[model samples]
Target: MLTRLDLMAGAFRAGAALALSEPEIRGLGRLVRQGDVCFDIGAAYGMYTYPLAALVGPGGQVHSFEPLPNPFRLLAAGRRASGAERIRVNNAALGPAPGRELMTLPYRFGLPIHGWAHLRTGQRRPGRPISFSSTRTLKVEVRGVDEYCEDHGIDRVAFMKVDVEGFEARVLEGAARTIDSHRPSLLLEIEDRHLDKYGMTSADLADPLRERGYLMYAWHRGRWARVNSVTTARRNYLFAAQGGL
Candidate 1:
């Protein structure tokens, strides 16, 4: 939860509105439809939520998940300000399993970049140009996407965007049923460094998608190319289901 002081400071310090860049928005528009439901996992300040709501339209709904308080507050504020009623923001994390988990919010010079917060038990790589300290932590609720959909009576999801730092695999795991049944298009960030923190590699993150017959593509030089493997570098990959939406 965010305190009054944090909300005030964040609203002013947040500066420009957080939304997907032009290329990303265009890329997403290709996958989602006007009446489709979508999910924006690790949604830091509605970067994709507002845009998704617009893409999906009022008849559609965009469920955004953001665990950290600072960004969660901003996310909710942005949703309200945008008047995107179809966008529902959730202040919780999602993982393979539903339970309480510890999330780390790193601070540089005592300021937090809400987007950088991640869920990991292990420490980051040693010695960077600037030292980042995990000065704050919050125990957040984790839910499975399959369970969430079932409870909410959501039969289909046109697209699901996952960017949970390094736990992208876990998010996919929780959404197994949804993937198998609904065949939603997946746009998830593949960052090997974050996966390494949890003893996972980039390839491990793509296993389920591969098993589900998802054709993987990475954006290269402003265009997407089919990829059999992803590197440790930070990038988003689009997984299109075979013979499905």
Candidate 2:
């Protein structure tokens, strides 16, 4: 007999499988390896965590960070259900330093709020505030990747996936040392509205990686789409350090 949560988890997994094309999944699979150290920043409900854990195998390790209470609990539950020893769950938001910050979650599934606020074109409204969860500011711990790896004795990080709402720039700033030292591949989400909220643009995100000798390519329609900063929303960009070790 399975619990309702288990059923929901199963449904979520199934939906993800159906939603994501095979090539996209394969591309994500290719970014990691056995015994490698991977980071899933802003891991919402373990959508990528579980699959990544399995991809990395028992020898590799995954550190998933999520700050929101609801999603954090879901990530913990997913980790437990996965029974994968290599996945370590952390409840925190990664930024340039360790401190407290406020995060605004969506009131509805597709209703964008905060910096990333934008109307979901072609999507029907789910309803009013009653149909959506209330928005609140919660204090969350923020840390740099370099500090985290140094303290944990993780010498090399193979891949880092970041989806920190509108704070991607800050998150990247905090991981400068780590990026310089480990030269890990990065999978970053970039939304124009979100960047605008922080007074940044897609160019700001791409310029740094380009300066560091990283090659940028977008994930789109089940394949890697070579593109520039102007057209990033089709999918997240993948940055691999030139001559990565």
Candidate 3:
């Protein structure tokens, strides 16, 4: 009863689900129950959102924010196909505060390609002119984690995943209140090269979380690695709040 295209789509979805459902990643999902809320920043194609929605079940909610149009469309389509009604999709970028800013794209991929000018050194591919496109950027509301919880009546957050390109610092800044209050475990992506473009170093990215009582661990070789030096090209670091204060 299924066409070839249907079978292919099913296979693709299955593979995607597996890649995003790794143990370390699913650990966050397991933290969310039937009524908790989770936020997914830069949710490219809802790779993690669908599984998260399943973890949260019918009662919990997942708010996914994507700034770029290409991936945002795919995220929305995936949510629909998965019947993830508890997931709310927002088409805007989150920053330190709420304001419209220029977002640059040099690559077709969903991740941050070329926003930081300093990191632009020698990375540009030859013979490819940087493409410039602008959308009506919206200053979506910004809230610290604590404030967001207070506003939404969220007493506790099971998990928070942040992957805001080169703007992870700003995202963390805005969520300081939440981090300080609820102490929700955080899964963040850190790229040294990307941060270097904004005059930021790896310490600048990790230090704050350390100060906030979060322990840093990297994902590598199908497990969480405690040392960042052990990570590979596909590895990402996870920060777990040690003690809620």
Candidate 4:
């Protein structure tokens, strides 16, 4: 009975509500408390950073990362505006090794793309239908999670969100020591299309987490629910360690 306009308006309202209170905060609010530490890889423009800072309070620390130069600048600006001294912003990408890479930044309709920028790891093939109209490149620093955390004296992590497009496996591999030691709950984005660019499958993501004693969860039917496996249909997933949430 709903027209297209009505449907769009409903979707907009839903997004507006989500913007006000992120589902991550609502779902994992109990898990992460005041004074806890958090990480936001692929933080983009601080959409999650600011809200996360609110939940953690001034006592907690939120270390956020953005690889793209433009987004990193914007994220850093938001960090400054927040004046939350504990919220640390890093303009580097976390990967298997600490190095530098020429990451490809895509632009659609003459605007810098927000969600689909990826590391130029291999022979740059024409992305399936090439979502962006044009592209630019930037050399960005890459750090390993365990190394970074150790160097920065970060001994505990209550939560982490990893949304580096299809580079989930590499990120996880780099953070294996950190995950094993801290056992923080993880929110990640891993899509087949993104993985396909690197010749990876969803199982490449799932099996590792399972081996490390993690169960996958997806936000389903308006609530957090367990999922048996990661699939292309569901890109964003929550991984809880040391039992269910």
Which predicted model would earn the best TM-score?
4
Give residue 109's lDDT in candidate 3 (0 to 100).
Answer: 41
Listed per model in order, the count of residue pairs whose N, CA or C atoms clash below 3 Å is 0, 1, 2, 0
Question: How do the residues 52-126 of candidate 4 rate in per-residue lDDT, one tens digit apiece?
Answer: 666677689889999887788988886676567878999999888799987878899999876878887642454
lDDT of 2 at 118: 22
Task: Report the lDDT of model 2 for residue 55.
Answer: 68
- Write one digit per residue (lDDT tens) for candidate 2, span 1-245: 65443454355556656775222444665577878889999887776676666667678898998877777888898787766778899988888877677655566675534322221211233222234455544567777898898889999899998887557778888898889888999988876656665666788888888898888876566566566565743547788876642
Ranking by TM-score: 4, 1, 2, 3
Alpha carbon lDDT at 216, candidate 3: 78
Tell me the tens digit of each residue's lDDT in model 3 across 157-180. Answer: 767888765467877777777777
Q: How much is the lDDT of residue 13 in candidate 2?
A: 52
Cα-lDDT of candidate 1: 0.76
Stretches off by above 4 angstroms in model 1 are 1-22, 121-130, 221-223, 232-234
- For model 1 the local lDDT of residue 75 reads 91
- Flag regions of model 2 displaced more than 4 Å: 1-17, 20-23, 106-134, 243-245
Report, for every candidate in turn, its global Cα lDDT versus the true structure. Answer: 0.76, 0.71, 0.61, 0.78
| Residue 86 displacement in candidate 3 (angstroms) | 1.3
lDDT of 1 at 244: 42
Per-residue lDDT value at 185 in model 1: 85
TM-score quality measure for candidate 2? 0.80
Give candidate 1's TM-score: 0.84
Best by lDDT: 4
